[model samples]
Target: MGRMYGWVAAGLLAGVAQPALAQEADAPSKDSGDIVVTARFRNENLQDVPIAVSVVNGDVAASRNLNTLQDLSTVIPTVDFRNGQSNKDRTVFIRGVGTITTSPGVESSVSTVIDGVVLVRPGQATLDLLDLDHLEVLRGPQGTLFGKNASAGVINLVTKAPSKVQTETLEAGYYEGGEGRIKASVSGPITSTIGYALSGLYASYKGNVFNAGTGHKVNGYDRWGLRGKIVARPNDDVTITFAGDYLYNRDNTPQGVYVSSSRIAYPTGVVTPNATLAGLLAQEGITPSANNKRVNTNFDSEVRDRNYGGSITLDWRLGGGYTLTSITAYREWKNHQTPDWDTRAILATGFPQGRDDGTVDFDQFSQEIRLASPQGGLVDYVVGAYLLAADTYERYQRSVTQLIGGAPVTNNGVANYGISAQNHALFGEANLHATDALTFIAGGRLIHDSLSYFHQRVSDTATGVSGIRPSFASSGKTDRVDYSARAGVQYKLASNANTYFTFSRGYKGPAYNVFFNMQAFDTQPLAPETSTSYEIGLKGSLFGGRVSGGIAAYVTNYDGYQANFADTYLGAIVTRLINAGKVQTKGIEADLNARPTDRLTLNFAVARTDARIKHFNCPAATTCTSIDNQPLPFAPDWKLSGGAAWKLPITDGLAIELQTDASYKSRTQYAITQTPDTIQPAYGIWNASIALIGDEHWELRALVKNILDQHYANTLAYGTTAGVVRYVPRDNDRYVGLNARIRY
Candidate 1:
């Protein structure tokens, strides 16, 4: 850690010694004060929007090698991204609040919006981002405009639009550990009134974990995607745009490595070594330890996903300073996964060998229309109506091999389920300019949701084996009507500074635990989750527009927070989704960006989140332990991130740039049960890069991540066999890479 800090200090000193130089010809200056966002369904200066937002420009993302949400989380102190064994299990948290469940009926607390469309599922947004114009992370409840599933926050992604001028870009990168990526984009005008932009990407990475059973790396990914957009302007009053995208991904690395094995006698508070698991490990010639990167699974774990979407948008100037806009979209996503339940290849007389295979098919269609009065009016307003219809189908099978009555036996259980939903909403927001320095903002959304599900399960055995669930069939329907509202008062401190206080009400619709193990008790829909939030913030630009940032403090209380908890059923431990009684999250966040000179830029951000459960609604007939007042999973007390970049000109057409960044996270627990074994100690990672620029057409760069060779786990969980396991991220170790790009 000391060496890493020394390297950063040296780079800063070296940058200071060089004389001030002009900006790189090919790199456009991204002045923080000039950033514009659509936080309120209209273009507005970020400083005047009265919301806590973090913006990442496309150039900054490229310079920092950020291609996915997981990568972006390292730079934003208030955001955390967790990866599971498959896309369906991926989750994003904002301010220590998020939903983690595999049931299709449940909705995420954090919503992801791309362009003008909202993704129905979190997995749909896990793909690699492409050609982004900018990304805005709106902190706190955003249910007023983003609609349902935004009780916590919203991730809004805006892609580059069709450019009227002809342009082309190509980028290629290679990193240590057999990872490589290539991206290309082109934009030009096809006719006097028509313009188009197209982009494509291909990326691959070799597995980082070594699989002793197959003598090969186990966790790697291969993915490719294409995106295109067209804009047509037939008259001065109207414009139309068409956009489409497709993605294909294949990977075989979703399981975690073993950390330890132990057994605790129920109700006796006694600990003992897991002899059965130890014997299995010995038979497979495997050792268990923290940060272990080797595994000995007999079968390959694979996940294949395909996604495609298209949208059409129309904008018309309705005259008299009013604008009308409409967007229609359709999307489909399909995934297949195969996993080895036990991470060992051991043969025993009566022991169980378990395997599970599953597939998901999801489709959605949506439409939205809004009318906006032009800005500068005494009362500017926007009203919108939205409709969405979605369907999800899942097929899962669990197979086990065991010995019954001294004879070998094999049993299989299969489940098929489907969820259908429809949502209708009316939303509106208005800003009243009381005076030149004071404004009042109000927004509300009325939403109605109708959801239904059908599930069927069949087992080869009459009563099912150890790993197979019993035969069952069930169908249910639920309907919910909810509303979200927000009111705020903004006061202008100066021409470039403002302060605001806001009160908001957020809502998430009812959900049912519709999974392969659905039972009669799980058919009832969980109550809706709701939140009340109060926020105070200050935002502005200082030093004559050279610096820009914001600070915010907020407290939110939630009722009926849905979460997964462990329960005993049929003499086995099972995980189920239930509505936890109450939770409270309070935090303070601060961020700043400064361009002290034309050739230097600096940024820093910090957050302190205190998220905990206020009450635990223990289920009936279960011997549940009390976890009240415990910190929420993945909610670190403190988080910080900072970066510095400096450009020095060597000649009229050549320049060199130096950049460094680091992120720190305090200790955090990974389990809702608050087990001591699932705690992750504090850790920090540092990264640096150097680049050479030539005449505005081409450039080359070299970068290294995890300069200290930090060893840490992204997530930790209790294993199925009375042990603990952890998921190791790719950047868990030191790696060096090179990147090159060209533009015309």
Candidate 2:
């Protein structure tokens, strides 16, 4: 069946190509009005780029309310976004590969770069999106030209720049069961040679989760942010730009609930279920049902996050048609959260207080200087140098109410960890216009990274009302050198069509597990992960822009795949990071766009992934369950998404537009070692929006999200004591909103 589908897809491409050649004498196809992006360090048409890339425009994002990464995934078929235990934690997967740990010293496999600056932490990428110019998702490895830690792929976000023309825009909206939001931006010329722009955003929401125990709302949200940018042209050949932004957010913490009680029925081993904990939750007024509305917790919890950053860029057009560019950036990020560890209100033996407090801070600085020769020459080249320095600190505290001298008292344990890192790199890429129909490209990078860390763990025993002293310390340092390379050939089939094939190698740096608990294996840092990928694709327009499409197939092999393992240490459970051997993923992705009429447009995207762990062997202190051929975690085999839009003129100055989109995903497992409780069944979601525009200056829109009110677990986890618990990070109920915007 899969082979038949593949054949049909290929046949459709061939059919389009045959007609395109037959009409060679005809006029060239009209532009599809497709977006342009800077994914390859230069502004180019999306279809003209020799890589598989998905572009989403600012207007489309505003209409779809794509304020977060999770919202963006609905449009990109191969992307998946998952939140960790806290709402502030983010894990983004592209092409079925990504980093699994949010600990300090570990970076994301799929890097997120904003305006040419890479976000040092994955969680920082979850900030609200406003005044965006466009977002580009580049599939496959990009480490050769892009910076390090891009073993999976890259998500590039470009914001609207300061313009010479005066413009102002304001938008406000309210959601039925979600939130209220307001955004404003203004741009104008500060002087004949300078331009400035400022933007601000505010949003708040009373979450859907009703806490029956405390009579207070859980998972509510509140946030605001501001950004300013300035551009100056000292001369016709030199330009400089500066940008800064600050954001603050606070929200109630999320609580996990039991989804299923079924245990893995191993023939030789006995596993216990959470019957007692389930009964206690029920007794505490917690109700777990299809609606998933209520959470019972005796402790108070909240999440607070603050992020601020700035960047400066200088560009100069040198003699001999060469361009020199320099980018310098600095950022600071801090986040703190308090969580109810037990998810139950009852006072149990092991989790009497059931409280865990954690805080993380990061300060990062980076500089990049690159020079590019003019394109269209017989041979063009780009060379660059990069430097990065960062400091990270994390503190965690776990508390429990225990009996001391027959009286209840609190006993707390605390752990602190810090990491300092420095990285330097030299990279270059060349494009050779070999012939009229074919071009060859090659790139390589040499990177060296050094890291040092200090950590200590301590505990205070209950002293009938007071406490005791602290414990020991540990320190370590390590450094290594790594390299990446890429080679590709692109053939121009016609003025409007192209075909390309590329092979690339990517690398991720080594990391240490920075959790509070101490496990023997976890104390030793894990090795770096690497990947090699091969891809081939075709892109072009058909029928005078009435139809357009691109299709690509890629295979990636991973060595020393990073994975988290659960193990026992003196009767207590601890998670250790390990290199779990080889993994292979091969997939095909297709996208189609059509403008059948002047007022009607349609688009669709589909992906099929075959991702599996090729080899694995558990380390000591860990149980070696049978998982040799399991599918990679959170990777669905098949995904489909499509949308349509229509615009009709109602009067000389008024028009109405309607749009609808839908997405579907197949069943997927949540953990590397497959378990029945960790599987999330197939589900689908639909969204729609209608807008009224008056002279393109004022507009009103009505949007409906999750029109079907689909019920599915956002994430699932298998716990030793709690069995299976699912976390629903988003509201399950349907959401409806009305927005109004004006521009001048």
Candidate 3:
């Protein structure tokens, strides 16, 4: 089925290839308009870039109510986002490749960059985006220019700049389930040479999960943030910009909900009821169900996160049309969480039963300098150097009570871990115009990484439980150097159309599994991951600005893919990161935007991905089965998204607008082992909105999300003692809301 779609896409590319129309000039029509992008570190027309990229304009995002990366994933079929126990564990995937782990020493394969500053941790990008100018998602490896940790791809976000004219904006919204939000911003010129912008936001939600024990909502949040920017011209030849932001978030959402008590036998593919877990649940008068919406926990979970950052940028126009750019940045993230591990209201002989508290502190400093030659020459180039230094510290404490020989017993333990890292890189890219109709592109990066870790564990009392481990201390260090490169050629089929093919090499640094449960064997540094990818794409416009879009096909293979698998630690089920063997992902993607008339617009996107394991290096002392051909977790075979908008004039001073969007994905497996209990069935969601707009001052909108009230899990997993558990998302139920905005 996937092969068929690939062929169809290839045919479409061929059909669009036509001889250059000498009558038509080699430039885009004025009616088509132009989208400017910095995908290659320079402003260029989107259709001219030889890469597979997608753009989301800020105005379109505002109308769709997209507030975070997770929200953006629904409209981009080639990307996927997953949430975990807390913000620190969230993960993002592009082209079926991503790293999933809680170790601070490890970096994500997919990187996030905001306003030219790369984020040290993926969790830092989870904050609500505000006043965005636009967003770009680049598929496949992007390490040649973006640098390390971009082996899979990159998500680039650009915020609105300070305005030359004075402006003030205010917005307020209220949704079902007691969710409310307010936002305001002001921008203008401070002087003839200096301009400034300031924005602030506040939001609150009264969760959806019902806590049967406490008679209150369990998964709710309160968030607020502030951002400011200043731009100064200084002189006709130089420009300086400064930016800073701070955010605070607090929530009480548990790791997951108990969904079932079914267990599967290891290595035999047998399913049966977990009698032991069922007996324990019955003691507390609890029954597990697939549609479970209530949880009886004795304690409330708490997660508090604080993030802040600042950056300074300098751009200088040198002699002979040469440009020099420098950027320096510093950022910090601190998080503290208290979770109820047991998820039950059982009475025990302890002050606080079945609870764990953890804290993390991370900081990073980075500097980048680059120079670029002027465009429209036979040969143009960009060269850059990057340096990064980062450190992370974590502290964890666990307390639990269990029945030992018909008597209640209590146990307590604590663990501390720290990691330090440094990275340096030199990168460059150049384009050679062999002819007016043909061009060649090449880029490469040389990177060096140094990483080290320290860890210690201590127990307050000796217990007979098999899950307890002896006190221990461990440390390790590693260093390595690697390189990534890309080569491609593009041919202009016509004035408004082009075709290109490229090969890329991607690399990710080595890592250590330095977590709370780290043992002697885990001290060894895991092998670095590497990949090679091949891609062919075509981009163009048709019908004299009526249609514009792109189509691409890609295949990527990875060695030493980093993933989490189920294992046994001291007679208890546990999950740990390992260098899972080889994996390959091949797919076809297409996106289209059309303006049939001045009153209507339509957009569509689709992806057919086949991500599978080519080899499995089964870890010793672990349950092993047939998994060589299993699909990677969170990867679906097919994904699609489409939307439409229509504008109707009510009068000379007012108008009515209608919009709707829909998305769908095939079934997904949530575990590497392909366990039946960890499968999420296929699902789809639909949303629509109606708005009334004034000439240029104010607007009101009414929106409905999850129109079908689809009930599905965001993710599924096997619990150590609770059998199967699932994460319930906020959109599992239908909801409606109203938003209002004023501009002056």
How much does candidate 3 score in TM-score? 0.93
Model 1 stretches with alpha carbons more than 4 Å out: 1-32, 263-272, 349-351, 405-407, 568-573
Report the poorest 10 consecutive residues by lDDT, candidate 1.
17-26
Ranking by lDDT: 1, 3, 2
Cα lDDT of model 2 overall? 0.76
Candidate 2's TM-score reads 0.92
373-398 in candidate 2: lDDT tens per residue?
99888888889999999999999877
Backbone clashes in model 1: 0
The C-alpha lDDT values of all candidates are 0.83, 0.76, 0.80
Candidate 1 lDDT tens digits, 41-81: 87777788888988877656765668888888877889887
Task: Enumerate residue pairs that collide in model 2.
Answer: none
lDDT tens digits, residue span 1-744, model 3 = 553354334324322211110111113443555566788998777778998987887645764567778778877888887877678778888987888888888888898998888997788888788777788898998998885678889898888889879999898888899888888999999999999999998988888877777787877789899989999998898989899999888888866777887776544768888676666556755577665666677777788989899999998999787899998999999999897776767653221246789999999999999999998899999999999999999998777677656687767778899899999999999999999879999999999999999999897554323334557799989998998899999999998899999999888889988777676778888888888999999999888756777899999999999887777653445667789999999999998777777777777788999999999888656657869978998889988777677778899979987777777788988788888778788877777789899986788989988776777787788764547877777777889999888989
TM-score, each model? 0.95, 0.92, 0.93
Tell me the number of clashing residue pairs for each predicted model. Answer: 0, 0, 0
